[model samples]
Target: MNKPLVVMLGGSGFVGRHLAPRLVAAGYRVRVPSRNRNMARDVGCVPGVELVNCNVHDPAELRRVLEGASVAINLVGILNESGHGGAGFNRAHVELTRNLIGACKEAGVGRLLQMSALNAGRGTSHYLRTRGEAEQLVRQSGLAYTIFQPSVIFGRGDGLFGRFALLLRFAPVLPLARASARFAPVYVGDVADAFLAAMSRKDTVGQVIELYGDEVLTLKQIVEYTARCMGLKRLIVPLPDALARIQALVFDFVPGKPFSSDNYRSLKLDSVGGVDGLHRLGIAKTPIDAVVPKLLGEAGRQTLLDRNRRVR
Candidate 1:
């Protein structure tokens, strides 16, 4: 019997890095479309995974990639503002979803997993509002699709908590925004597993599942947890909402502006997943504390935790 084929869009990213191997292990042939094919070359040796270069925004190219695939997963998203002066987060989040859905329908792809974010429907911020709109489009696309709405994803190579870990090593005090906005950050590995579950089960088709960590915490609490787990002595200073906006505005022009005015706006919204979908999926959540020590270096982990205990 031939294995099913699953074409994955945005396969070079953090989530993709974790997901590709799982799919290959399950006897499914995986094809990845990335701008820089070389970044994904390591995946080529994983049994049946292939890589190709294609522009995600181009419908024709997307269709070509989607052709004859039993399943497709779209994981493309940009957190920072685009330099093209083009569509902001709104277009990248909502408009691109519309384009991908149409392309998938034309290519006759039967199964799709649309990746979305938690707390996305209430229009909390421009970013979240756009995410909500995109979810609505997918829900009404008439395709058998599974939506994976995950909270902030963290892992060894994650862009979220990992970056903070790096900063705590050098910076004396960590200045953060919306420290009160709570999150139940899901692990990248768990997120990948959720995708695999969605791919294998027809029951997941046309369903929306939310992924989250076992622990719910504020932004400051997460930073503290990471610092403690890494064994670091650092002070976490919470910037007021207004001041955080100013800081983000000042740093907007910085290269790799992961922190920006728009990002600050997004922090105002709580990032926990709702029970409506999470309970139905039966996917248990992993807390950030359980895995931080493993991902952090031994020395750093000891130092941070030692310092954290003293401070507390």
Candidate 2:
């Protein structure tokens, strides 16, 4: 029997960067199609991996990439608002998914693996709601599919934890948005492993699996913890929901702005997954504290510089 070919979208992003190598290690040949092929070449450099440049939202381009792929993983998502490029969550989360499903169907891709979020649900913020809708569309596509809805993923290359670490260094006082809301920040490597497992396991098809860290902590707790790990002395001031939402709104108007009201809503709910799925999937959630020190390292200038340089 031959190993299946996995076609990955948005492989240049944080999760995809970690996932590409892990998939290769698991004996699957990976193909990542991105808009900028040169930038994505790193993904292809993984043994048994290929890279292509294509617009995932275009049905024809999607089909071209889907050719000969046994499974397709859609990992494309935008955190900040971008002008003209249509970085809105609705297009990337909903419309792109719709197009991918259609292209998969057309190209006869055998399976679809969707990377989603743990807090995705009705009445949640637009981020969560859009993610929920994308899941619904995937489920209804009449294809063999598995969904991995993970909490805010953290690791060496992850944005969630790394962003907090960056903020703590420059600012002596942390203005926390949704400080009361909680999360179960999963390690990036664990989440990537879960994706590989879902692709190969029969029981994973057509199931929505949620993933989380071993423990839960509030937004404020995570910020404080990250600061403490970096050996920074900082004060955390919890901002009211209204103020946070307004801050997000203001930032949304600026290009490449990281904060927004949608993000505020996303943080309002707990990110921990119900543990039943973890048990069923035969995965033991990795704890956040166990891995933080390794990734962030002891307080040092070189480590901070390395992290900051990666951001640009």
Candidate 3:
């Protein structure tokens, strides 16, 4: 018997890297559509994963990927847009979701798992606003869907900690905006478990699972934690609102947009979750201290090995 085909949009990302292998292990044939196939090559090389170059934002292109697929998962989200406008956020989050829904309907795909953010729709930031907008569409799309609103997700290669670790390594003093902004960092593995749990249980079809970790830490605490894990002594400077706005405005034009005004607006609301979605899903939370240090250690070893090879 042939395995069920699961189509993943934006499966080259951090979470997708972990989730795709889990799906394959669960006896599903995973198809990942990326704009650049080379970006998803790690996934493509994995057994039972079909990585194809296709523009998921395009309806026709998305439809082609969704054909005969049993499920569709959208993990595409951007923290900042190319420029200082809402258009990029809308296109990436809302419009892309609309296209994905239409394509699913056209292909008769029955299930959809959407990755959303905590405090979505509650903030003025384009990132959360469009995330909320996309969630609304998924709710009304009339398809069997499960929406995941996750707090800061942490794991190997996660954007939250990994990015911070890299930045903290260079700077002795870190200027942070909204340092008091709080978050219950969720483990990537628990998040994947929640999705898988939701996938198997049809009762979760109309449910919104807010995934979060066990610890509630502030922005300052998170950065400090990362620095400590790396065995680095760093000074964390928490910027007040006045300074933060200026920082956001200045960083807006920075290449790669390390931070922006939209991100600043989003930080106004705490990223903490109300309900224990992981607990509700019957999955235990993985604490940051246990996992982060180990990953950092391994990463440090790898870095040293690369540096040694370069010396030759």
Which stretches in model 1 have alpha-carbon errors above 4 Å?
83-86, 276-279, 298-312
* Cα lDDT, model 3, residue 266: 95
lDDT for position 104 in model 1: 88
lDDT of 3 by residue, 120-143 (tens): 888789999999999999999999
Q: Model 2: how large is the Cα RMSD against the reference?
A: 3.6
Name the candidate, 2 or 3, with the larger TM-score value: 3
Q: Give the TM-score of candidate 1.
A: 0.89
- Reference-based lDDT, residue 41, model 1: 76
Clashing pairs in 2: none
Task: Identify the runs in model 3 with alpha carbons over 4 angstroms from their true place.
Answer: 298-312
lDDT of 3 at 11: 85
Task: Tell me which residue pairs clash in candidate 3.
Answer: none
Q: Write the per-residue lDDT of candidate 2 for residues 64-133, one digit (tens) a residue.
A: 9998889999888776445523347788899999999999999899799998888676555667777888
Once superposed on the true structure, which residue ranges of model 2 sit more than 4 Å away at CA?
83-87, 298-300, 303-312
Scanning candidate 1 in windows of ten residues, the lowest lDDT window is 276-285
Q: Specify the highest-lDDT model's number.
A: 3
**lDDT score of residue 236 within candidate 2:** 96
If ranked by lDDT, best first, what sequence of candidates would result?
3, 2, 1
- C-alpha lDDT of all candidate models, in order: 0.80, 0.80, 0.89
lDDT of 1 by residue, 195-290 (tens): 887777789888888888767889898888778777777899999877888888877888888587767777877888776354455666566667
